[model samples]
Target: MNIEIVDIVNKINVILVEEFEVDEDVIEAGKNLKDTLDLDSLDYVDLVVIIESNFGVKLVESDFANVITFQDFYNLIERKILAKQQ
Candidate 1:
């Protein structure tokens, strides 16, 4: 279970790392998505869309705004995926 979680987190990290040209090794769960990454509004939307597509979850703008860290983002995806299966 932990491994699966890490795998998804890595996928998210890969997107951030590639888009922002940041080192993936430095990205931590608690890191602020906007502050540390210096991401702008457009990037955030792109990220939200990518995450939704990645997890097969539909993300509302309000919901995406509330999500902060990478881990929080993963938790949202996890919940949505679980809900779909139930």
Candidate 2:
């Protein structure tokens, strides 16, 4: 169940575009995730749900405490995916 970062990126991009109605161009690694996506509290819930369903990685609220950038979010997902594999 090894997952590559590119796979994570592609899935995340698709999820953001389809589920969150985010513009693809704005979904950059360097951007601030919440601000770039215009996400509110409720949107975080939806994001959690989508991430769980898409990657089988259940993310808790505290997992986002240090997640400021989209790259940080991707790294979190990658770590969770690797943890799940273990």
Q: Which candidate tops lDDT? A: 2
Give candidate 1 regions above 4 Å deviation.
Answer: 1-3
Instruction: Return the top candidate by TM-score.
Output: 2
- TM-score, cand. 2 vs. native: 0.97
Report lDDT (Cα) of residue 20, candidate 2: 90
Overall lDDT per candidate, in order of appearance: 0.74, 0.94
Tens-digit lDDT track for model 1 on 20-44? Answer: 7888867888877677777788877
Q: TM-score for model 1?
A: 0.77
| Model 1, C-alpha of 33: deviation from truth (Å) | 1.3
Could you tell me which 10 consecutive residues in candidate 2 have the lowest summed lDDT?
Answer: 1-10
Regions of model 2 farther than 4 Å from truth: none
Q: After superposition, how far is residue 45 of candidate 2 from its true place, in Å?
A: 0.1
lDDT of 2 by residue, 1-86 (tens): 78899999999999999999888999999999999999999999999999998898889999999999999999999999999888
lDDT of 2: 0.94
Clashing pairs in 2: none
